[model samples]
Target chain A: MMSKIVRTMASFLILFVLIYGLYIIMHGHSTPGGGFQGGAVVASGVALLIVAFGSHSIHRSLLERRLSILISIGLLIFIGLAFGGMAKTFFYNFLVGSPIFGHIPPSGPNPGEMSSGGVIPIMDIGVGLNVAGGLSAILLVMALATTVMEVEE
Target chain B: MRKIAIAVSLSIFIGFLIATAFLIHPFGYPPSEMDDYIIENTQSETGANNAVTAVIFDYRGFDTLGEATILFTAVTGVVMLFRAKKKREK
Candidate 1:
């Protein structure tokens, strides 16, 4: 069993890393790291939990079915945004007129936003969710496959 | 028993080593010119900041559509393989 200090450190580290990674994803359009990188970091946090405890422990929180659903939902969000927006015009910027301070309006003609960048944030969020779900799915499935115990009858 | 354990572990380790050493590219390298072109062009067309997604979903949607079909084909192959294995085991 881990000592109190170690447990506290683990808890603190988990929160810090996950939130930091989320910050990276949120500011991805304006900053260095994007959705994939941030998403991988988020997965790393989940992996850290698996490494510290066992697989069944993590499963208590993020189940396999939930992870699969999240992945599908993320992909659907992106697809829905695409076709739904495309319905308006061929290559039309769906977020053209949205309001923002640092960036120009998203709807007009020019692309790239401080905020005017269009649906990139929504896309980033979708990709982030997709990746988080995917990584968790792989981890959860592997955990389930290996969670057997040998019994002597 | 130790010998059996060692041999099994060794073989699995060796398999992983071979796969990692050769299956993945020899070394990491910078993106090629084609990649650079897609990066600039897709971001331009899709108004999507992520050039990769733009290319996959918009710029070359047909290509991705074909790739998805190929993935479905592979899944079919895997199911067939599993059925054959079950039949043999039974």
Candidate 2:
């Protein structure tokens, strides 16, 4: 556990980090940041919480099983979306003309549209979830291992 | 003799690195026709304003799949290793 001030600050800051990360992931189709980058940002926030309140406490809430399930779901969503376009070809942008996320932006510089990018934003979300879960699981396990080592010592 | 050999190899490696650095294409100006095509048609074809995202998620999705698989395997391996350790302790 950390000082009460540190814990309070971490709890407060995590919300902003999470929102920023989601923004990056959702706007990936029209922005510089993408799934991997945004996921890393969110994982960093999880790391902050883990550091503020020891891994054991954090583990109680963010279980390994839950993270694994999250990863699996993300992977399934990504692959499912990919297969959705199999009628034309694998990984086709089938949603481009559909009602969902189907608006095509005018060519050249523009403000960009949220309802654009077809399957790209969805894929970004999937990949972001997968990355966030995987990285958090890794950090949690590593922290737990360190605590175990301390106990052994 | 070993020290002399190490020095020769290190010099040779450094020389190769320098040669490659000098010989490589200028920054951001590679001679590839595919880049032009992607840049021109990415908006129309993929409907993504970000060309980089379009390329990764659409033009080269198989590679992303491979990357995700690698991450999954790594996480599974780590979790299994730690779980086994915990079991041994109990």
Candidate 3:
């Protein structure tokens, strides 16, 4: 376990990092950042948490098995969205003028509506989830393996 | 002899890096017709305010697919490698 100061700082900052990361992912259709960058940011927060709380406790508390499931679900969401536009063509932006994420964006530079961007936002979400799960899983696995090696030694 | 060869290779590597840096296009002045076309048509074509997102999830979706595939493959490989092994009674 980390010191109280470290833990407190981590607990305080983790939420902000997570919220900022989600903001980046959700606003990806209008902002500079997108899914992968946001995901990495969130994963960095997770790494911070791991460092603060130690991996074993986190592993026990947070079901490590569910991470793989999350990864699968993310991939499914992405591929499913891709197939959702199959009526016209593969990855066709068919929802570009419909009710579901189909609000027409204003031409030229302007503050964009969240409801706009067709399937881009959804795809961003999918990629964000996939990256967050994959990166965190990799980090958790490495930490756990190192602990096990230490026990063996 | 070995010291001279190491110095020669290090200088060559630095020279290559310097040449590439000088040869690169000026900052913020990339000359590409494709970029202009994408920027002009992103909103109308894909209904996305962010051209980068439209490019990733619409214009170049196949590239995103490949990226997703690579991530999935990596996760699967890591899980398989570090999974717990059961012990057999002797």
lDDT top scorer: 2
Per-residue CA lDDT of candidate 2, range A116-153, in tens?
Answer: 78999999999999999999999999999999999899
With candidate 3 superimposed using the best TM-score fit, by how many Å does residue B69's alpha carbon deviate from the native?
0.9
Candidate lDDT (C-alpha), each = 0.61, 0.92, 0.86
Error of 3 at A141 (Å): 0.5
DockQ, prediction 3: 0.67
Clashing pairs in 1: A96-A106, A96-A107, A97-A107, A113-A117
Per-prediction DockQ scores? 0.12, 0.79, 0.67
Which model, 1 or 3, shows the larger TM-score?
3
lDDT of 2 at A49: 93
lDDT value, candidate 3, whole model: 0.86
| Model 3 Cα lDDT, one tens digit per residue, A78-108 | 9999999999989988778888667776787
Model 1 lDDT per residue over A58-152, tens place: 77887766866776676666666666567675334466454542233233334444432466566567667777766766665555445532111
Which runs in model 3 stand beyond 4 Å of their true positions? A112-115, B1-28, B84-90
- The alpha-carbon deviation from the true structure for residue A5 of candidate 2, after best TM-score superposition, in angstroms, is 0.4
Worst lDDT window (10 residues) for model 1 chain B?
A: B67-76
- Higher-lDDT candidate among 1 and 3? 3
Model 1 residue runs over 4 Å out of place are A1-6, A88-92, A97-113, A147-153, B1-90
Interface RMSD of predicted model 1: 5.8
Per-candidate TM-score, chain A: 0.77, 0.95, 0.92
Q: Tens digit of lDDT per residue, candidate 3, span B7-80?
A: 99999999999999889998888898999999999988888777888999999999999999999899888767
